[model samples]
Target chain A: MDNSDFKGKNILIVGLGLMGCSFADAFRDLYPQKIYGFDINKEITNYAQQKGLIDEGLTKINSAILGECDFVMICLYLDDAVQFICKNMDGFKKGCIITDIVGVKRKIVSSVQEVLRDDIDYIPGHPMAGKERQGFGYADKKIFKGKNYILTPTKFNKSDNVDYLEKIIKAIGFENVVYTDPEKHDEKIAFTSQLCHVIASSMVDINVDDDISNYEGGSFQDMTRIAMINSKMWSELFIANKDKLVNVLDNFLTSIESFKMLIEKEDPKLIDKLDIIKKSRESL
Target chain B: MDNSDFKGKNILIVGLGLMGCSFADAFRDLYPQKIYGFDINKEITNYAQQKGLIDEGLTKINSAILGECDFVMICLYLDDAVQFICKNMDGFKKGCIITDIVGVKRKIVSSVQEVLRDDIDYIPGHPMAGKERQGFGYADKKIFKGKNYILTPTKFNKSDNVDYLEKIIKAIGFENVVYTDPEKHDEKIAFTSQLCHVIASSMVDINVDDDISNYEGGSFQDMTRIAMINSKMWSELFIANKDKLVNVLDNFLTSIESFKMLIEKEDPKLIDKLDIIKKSRESL
Candidate 1:
């Protein structure tokens, strides 16, 4: 958790996209030794290398490339994470603590753990912060600053792995670090994260037929800014966390039904309900 | 429209809240001849007096207060605009043109027309502008600048009065002013305005809970900025436009169902559906 703890540690960041590269940027500033990176996309690897976000970049995660790091952080897509760990688990350092920057936990933990070597611990960690813009060009060193980072450690995971992951996240400038059971983590995120993108994408989809959309003001644009998100990535997240996401969707739909009843009855109570929500948001 | 056209012409602005006061400020600056204002809240009238937003400020509208204005704009709640006009009709000049800022159209047009004398013309308009912040203190002269101002006129309303109101709106710096039939106006707004607030309020209400709201970020705040809206005022609008609002809510709930199904399938093919929606929005 100190400067000495980070000194001379070799860390491998897999998938040099915005999240992966941002991790390298934050770590490279704090660590004294190697920050290695790998991405299937050569353009992204070259971009991260040209930007000096990583000390070494490889187009593929070969055994030689994966073997050099004391720690490995999987930053690939959910499917890619599984494939990479399965193919390269033997190459990873014997006692290395592996973590991930994936948004969801329940699926990521099970998928990676199934493929990893018994000697390595696959700890699931998510830094709940990002911009609409993606890729290394848009990466920011200050992203995790003053943000909440959640770590989900299963019963099979080593306690030391959780502590080490927390220390890394803390060193990257996150102000709050907490642990939760994997189910609770996914359920809370289904409400807080996944449902948000769904609603945003839905709003934009509804307004597509409106001619006045060309003249949309800040309110409409603000409501749908994330509509441009990488659908491939989010669709994967949505499916991976389907059960919890569906529960959150049910709660959201229930609220909408209550709203419809208020409108149908011409009720004044809707205002007070809205006021309650507004007051609660202010407290947040 | 012109300074000469407005010279010595009296204009009455009912309500004198943010929307009304901003109208008065712009009209007073552009017209400068006679801008009379009325509000149930006397403190608002006194505050507008201190800021010189009106030529006359009165707590109530009577024959004396309404008779002096050549034009009357009802900026009161949708439920109150009709009653406001009915109670104060005797005060209006016999040949004056009346307009309103209420969101719904059919009831407003019918109620106002039923209560008005044959010599007066009732033209309803809704300026597609304003902020979440309400009241005179938040009023600004530039609120309507570059915004779309919708004028909803019934078949019985005079074309000349519509032209006059359009000119006044254009003179006040509104770039685009469109006129539409009353029923169509309400239906379009059901989708555009009322439904937007309902969705925003409901989304915030569902997501914000006791346990994890403190971890909210920009997406949640952006999605629910209008949740901080004046609930009493918005409730009245929703109820008065109940039929249209309910229809819009039904459609929105349908779209939400589509979303739920997509997430449930978690089939990679569903990503194509999201891409289509995303590209459709991008084209807009």
Candidate 2:
């Protein structure tokens, strides 16, 4: 089974949400042996199955279904994902490759590293792609197109398993696969993902008038587009990476304060500061 | 000249940069008598003329050019727009309706109101549309489509002239025309346009890595897209609207700080706060 193509693999999708169904639908096209989708709610898994996203749907932990899967994709939220995996640790096939689509890395990797069966390899990953919408009905395979997939591979993760996963990731339309450690992934993501959500969410929170979007050109709309967030999911992400997020937030506050001071004092250096920021952004 | 159609009107497009060229291009299709474009740089005016964005380009303010214009659209930066309008107040034709596309309204309307000729009516307006790219060459007439055009009409502005301006504004593809006083316009705009720019610019300024964009998903890109700032122009705008911008910035800082503290303390209320923010943004 070393470096096996997805065509010969039996896969399990642990949550029938947007990310789960998307991966299930993509894998269906690649002719996987069978897909067993698990969701605590039977309705979601049934809907996914009816949509041809998975070959079968399971409401309970069927040891046979879990034992047959060569690849298991856990698409649950942070704490729930850890709980699901740790509880079902003994059900997975020997040397089964288990990966997750959790947002944060440090907490997920550390928690999973403690209870995993040594025979099975666990790879922690984040697919940096999603719409503002959620749920199985909103799932689209194209969401993965032209997106980055970050892998924080534990030392126990087999190189062959990582390569096999990368093959499946690329086949599903991911444009880039970035390899890094759990700590580095969380730090960069804290800056790129969590910090942006914080700023966008705060921008929305400050609107004094409900109709203020009427005055917006394009800037306000673009900045706050992501503010149509799933609140529970995001708060969990924020608290999970609070240390890194707070650090980045402080840096952002400091940076904006300088602009405020420059404006407050009517300083001539404001132009230079704005010019430097513009040049830096243009490079990006 | 009472509520005249664009066909019989001669329009002047001042400061032939992106906004000026776009307006001129839109006016050409409406079959205005002639468009006299004014710019400080002779080469830019020549480029605009060669591109057919204007009928003729004037480097200096010609009394004949100013005198014949039934409508003068000042597309200059705030300070430059003020200087040009006040300096040439005497040259405008009687009952000529003048308007501006400056970001801030109070300053432009008040300055022009003090020295404006009684014979001619100045209707101050702000077109809530633009691209991050600058210059006439990048100007597109479609930028006005489905956008808001804000008007801050003064007491001296005649009813017929406001109607005349509204017709032209609608003809140029503006979807909505929002009417408010100068103070209200400044305040709302400070929250919508100026505050977004400040946040976007600061987001860029806080980047710890030049290669940070590589790690970004769509959120970071959307938030910082406007950070490609025109340093000198933006600095001028910030200083001009310092009081209003600072007030809103403080509110925004407070809002984000609440988020930071909520995350720092690992409070359960963070989810509720985020949920409220998400609902508020959805109402937009």
Q: What are the DockQ scores of the candidates, in order?
A: 0.43, 0.82
Candidate 1 on A37-60: residue-level lDDT in tens? 898888888888888888778886
Q: Rate the local accuracy (lDDT) of all candidates.
A: 0.78, 0.88
- State the TM-score for model 1: 0.87
| Ten-residue region with minimum lDDT total, candidate 1 chain A | A208-217
Candidate number achieving the greatest DockQ relative to the actual structure: 2
Top lDDT hit: 2
Fnat of candidates, each listed: 0.51, 0.86
- How high is the lDDT of residue A246 in model 2? 96
| lDDT, model 1, position B234 | 81
DockQ for candidate 1: 0.43
Give lDDT tens digits, candidate 1, residues B1-284. Answer: 32324677888888988899998888886655678788988888888888889877888666776776788878888878889889877768888888888767788887777777888888788887888778789999788888887787777777777787788888887888877777877777776667767777877787646666434445766777777777787887788788878877777788778889978876666688789877766665
